[model samples]
Target: MIIEKCNICPHACGGTRYEDKTEGSLCALPALPKILKSHLSKNIEPGLIGSKGSGQIVFAGTVLNDSECSVFDSESDNKKSRINGKKLAQMFLTLQKQGAANINLINPTAFAHLIMEALREQPLQIPVVYSSHGFDSLETLKQLDGLIDIYVPFYKYHHTQIAQKFAEAPDYPAKAQIALLEMYRQVGGLASNYKKGIEQGLLIRHRVFPDFSRESIAALHWLSHYLPEGTGLSLLTGNPYLAWGEEAKNKQPLKREFERVKTALQDLQMNVGYIQDRETGEFFYLDEI
Candidate 1:
């Protein structure tokens, strides 16, 4: 299953990735995995971080190449972080040994082929989670059917113009909708263990923008109507620093805005994950329904 012409992501840049040394892809990366870090973290979804913490593998590149992403801006030399699939498999084993609740793959869309190879080399004991940016191709996600146990993806935007304005991905909303539907079809609904947090299912996260509450509401409504009854939802307060360009510059949501969105989500009466306080780094979860 070597990728000769890379269609692993939505970009489908058609690079010769199997040739090892070639790097003509839009992500400017090879088929090899490039990891920034792999460690236990409690900063992720509350349901994912059990007693031992979620095993987070933050990959180096993104197909979207979002300018606001700190990882993309900070790393000057990505080649230094490159590792073979076998080594990535070893990292997974190490995390499992360290009592990680689940194997969380962050920003893995660009390296989907490489990750599949790694999983093949070393089958995971714990659930394999695909935490992505939501700009994914259905064909690529179909390849991960049996391999991925949980899908933690963002429903970033409901409006096509907003997606195109920020991420230069005009088709993001449509692609994300189809991809999420596929993810739900694969995993069904949320399943958890008392000791092991979330074991399997689709957990959708929507980051609330300062003046874009309508979009947020639209996303929530869509999830409520379309997804399964037990599907998990996380409403994250947007970070001003993570915003890019004049449209989002120095923008922060007012306290009242947060309250309004929170109240609307509570009204949904679904399984809410957590409402993060962007300023204080605190997490607030809704009482069990």
Candidate 2:
């Protein structure tokens, strides 16, 4: 949807489009033509694989807001959710028949629990990868842990940094990361550096921002060393030329960088996964059954 003045994200500035119903603000609304396309499917890197495609669901909004809260913008479609989490959960159950084993949720709000409850009605043995601005609590993770098979936390720009950029919420990043750390403890890994959870694991994402991968890489490094095991990761070396689509742009990195990260994972023998560095299989959208 083309939002005239979008405030759905950490960037609260209104640009003068029209009002968006999902965002409830003219700024966060979608422009025409941009609202018609809903054909979207993203490939998991070589690391975070499931036998079937990830079961994706787009809910209303987010719990975390940031300057880099570009998750919603990546989807070319206006994810005008079908109202509450109950319907959203039913939607996923339907997709399960079509080979959607995992999930990549967009704009999942605090009401995500409602969706989880839907799944819990008859729990999934499969994983549900959550894509959102970083920051989630252990309690929240525990609530979701029952319903989710895997946790994929997307770490956005730092809270302090997002505050500087959007000037809407300064503490978002900190709160989100704090939640992330708690999440790591619950399902990712423990603080003692020795504890490990029985659940699957987390696939931490670091999308290359603007013209750099420093912050993203640093996040990976820090996450990798923290647990006794390594953290599965996907480094989006490519950025969508468009300001918000950066995360979805799939670019191959230099052979050296690819090997370097690959080697580190090998060293740790971390239960790690990543997008393949090979250029041949760099397919982004395809219907696989």
Candidate 3:
């Protein structure tokens, strides 16, 4: 995984991850800060939870990115400090110490390797889990030798501008996917998919963006053709809505498009997980320590 502080994704904010001992880049975060929370939480949806429980970690500070892209929420949820690899390692160490069987990493990328490395020799090691974004190197699928049971990578918006604004993709939904595929192949393939509780390995996850579910669906269709069968797949609904405010409220039409994505998921026979409502968006984390 490329951990160098970057300005590549949608947030062109050009964050300095290595500087000031930060763990993340523009997200105004570099690594897991003093953990605000960590605990075991269940998925309102069963398949989503492949392990006994998932350990959720929330860091402090609003991350500064390349283009100021905000995927989950906006300025309000902004955190405070930058996290570091070792610090992030410690955070996971805390979860392992507490007996968390799985982990749910949101917008993960910053110090992904560090956290996984920390899991290498723990008691309640992570066998199945989710990433906030897409996988960096599927080779970990091989390197870890399938030690990781489940993986859910995201292919958000297809438009270059959206990728420019929300992610750090220069080409987007194309070359970026190619790179992701190569890594997956290196690890295992569809057979590599696993669930800690039942099934496991490489799960592809995508969410509809404002007026961009079409673009996201295109990426999914491409996966259906390109991805090996039996690979784990999950489609998240509009609970993926961005942090709303003035700019967000004005774009009502985009919400309709997101709704279409939910409808499309309902119409499909794919093995997926859907967030039923905001009430079901329950998360478990070690908030303090």
Candidate 4:
């Protein structure tokens, strides 16, 4: 399946994505979805995985291309990993058979249509996670009503200026809010059991930048009010190496800035998920809410 006129994302680039070539698209990705990496990762939010780990598939390209994204090296990755729907379905089953708690589709917004085709190829017993950079189109998400089980999106920033600066998406905050609301309508808050892990849910992840605690706080406030009660959240410190240059990694201290975000979370009474310790870079689930 190829997107002749791509409108899968909010950008509405209206590109013709052929099976082998992409024309006039901002993402510069082909219609055929490409894989960056696939592995069983336990180092994710606990809500998504169990003892076995989540079957994480990192796809190439993104709707909102942030300069600070470190997920994949676009030039080196996906040279020979272009896969069709059947092949992608097979990969999903393979991971499920390998005892993956869930199939986590990372950065999959641009290829959502193809991914939907892959999902239709087979019946998966485990949950399907749609993880992305919170730039999803409501129309695209509406198409995925029954297909996806979990929505894991990064609520990157609250202000339009910050979003534009980082992702070149001036309308990101508004689009993300609407998309998140639709996601919650589909899946609601997290429902996890000891045996089955997460059944279905909406989990919001936020990365607190060292100098952007105020924006983080405002984003958190929006989440607290808009999302359902007890919606799972995952907080992490922004990577200075990605946001700033390599030299800034040592210079920028995240602990203090992280504390401010934590205070905001506490004040909002939105403490029901994972919080990464900035000092040691360790993630601990917050259960003291």
Candidate 5:
């Protein structure tokens, strides 16, 4: 799949993603899909991971120009060979046969077109999880409406200053809000099966930074007001390694702030997902009211 002018992400770089070359593209990645790695793992949120495991496929590079707080920043290593749609489809099939609960595509916005190509050729029996940095284009997401089953997009920041400071995208909050709402519209709320685990849904992730607890609460407030009931959420612990500038200087232990955030979640009556322990590195699934 070759794009004359790539409008895959919110950046709208208008680059040419030819099969052979990437011209003027912000990501500078080939049009063809390049995968950094693939394996069945239980590293994700518990609701998504079944007894077997989730088929985790890490795509190389990203359309978003986020320098900090990118979950898959290490995947930027472009040494991996490019694979066609057919090869990609086969990988899904292989993982499914190996008893994977679902196929999770990480950092896939740049390769969204290629993924559509792969899915069209051969649809999977298991659910397809669309995980990204939450800077998606509406057009690109619309193209993937029926193809994706579960959406695990990150909601990084509520403030433009923090977004700009970290991601260099001042419009990150606006773009992410629109993108996430659309995702929920496509897949209303999280649906789990007794045996299959996460059958389909939208599970938004937000990493609570130490000093930015208020910002985190504000974002949660917006989500509680807009998103439908039973919508899944994952409150992650911010990675200190990614902190920079003022944020790095003022960073503190996440436990105290997280307690406040948890109290806020209860106050908002938005307790229906997972919360990662900053110290223990464990995910506490919250099904309690």
Candidate 6:
């Protein structure tokens, strides 16, 4: 299906994105993808990082207005560098040659059309990881059924008020729920190659907000109901760097809050990928927890 007006994301802003140099869209992107950076990184999920790290491609821009977004803090100008589908395919091939476990596409929802084109030009040998903000549309995800392998989506919020306040997307919670379900439907449950540290399945990452313990617990409960018994969950300690200029109310999570979230997750008895210590910033896995 041809996307004349960009409905790639859930926003459906209807901006004219067929032209190569078009602007005035929600993501401020052109038809071709603007590559921010591409590298093999060990900082990703422990399971995805084999002896050779996962090949990561950080795409420019976002559809959400997250107050605690780190992309803006790190990059001064995201629209400066650009690459077409063919070049992107070559980059994917290059990473595979260098022994990358999988090709991880960061913030790819905005450039989903171009990414699909790239894959068509050079079909990937390794698994394709779609690392997203969990605000994807079901139609777009259905189009990506056979292409994607691992779905690492960040389920940021379960409360509508919190989602609207921080992300300017009031319907985020509902959309995230449906999007995650579609992802699981496509990829099934978590399957791991422990010896190689390679995984092919759904790994949901949820960050515990400072004063949102209830919301965090609610999100966990929803996951427990819908997702498989041993779904991989990464409960991250919210990044202090992302909340730098935000309100004092939205600062780092408190010790008690962390304990509450940890206790709530423990009660669920799901597969906890990693949990960060509130004080020491240390990470513990399911067995350790």
Candidate topping TM-score: 4
Better of 5 and 6 by TM-score: 5
lDDT of 6 by residue, 16-58 (tens): 6643455457766567666777899888667777778989988
lDDT for each residue of candidate 1 in 119-207, tens digit (9 for 90 to 100): 99999889899999888899999999999999999888888888888888888888899999999999977764422378888888788
What is candidate 4's lDDT per residue for 59-100, written digit by digit as tens?
876666675555544623645667888889999998999999
CA lDDT, every model vs. true structure: 0.78, 0.47, 0.48, 0.81, 0.81, 0.78
lDDT per residue as tens, model 5, 1-289: 6797788889888999887578998877778866777889898788777878889988876665664435455444556677898999999999999999899998898889889988998888889999888989888899999999999999887889978877788998999999999999898887644223778888999877767788889999999998898788988876666443445533544678888888888888876778887777588875552
Query: Model 4's lDDT to the true fold?
Result: 0.81
Candidate 4 global Cα RMSD: 2.2
lDDT of 4 at 264: 86
Q: Per-residue lDDT tens digits of candidate 2, residues 126-193?
A: 55656555555445556665565556666655436544454245665555566566556656631222
CA error at residue 157 for candidate 4, angstroms: 1.3
lDDT of 3 by residue, 66-116 (tens): 222244333233454445555555666776566666555554444445556
What count of clashes does model 5 give? 0
Error in Å for residue 23 of model 3: 13
Candidate 5 residue-wise lDDT at 73: 52
Ranking by TM-score: 4, 5, 6, 1, 3, 2
Q: Give all TM-scores, in the order shown.
A: 0.90, 0.61, 0.63, 0.93, 0.91, 0.91
Backbone collisions counted per model:
0, 27, 56, 0, 0, 0
Over 4 Å off in model 4, which ranges? 73-78, 192-196, 244-253
**Pairs that clash in candidate 1:** none
Worst 10 residues of 3 by lDDT: 280-289
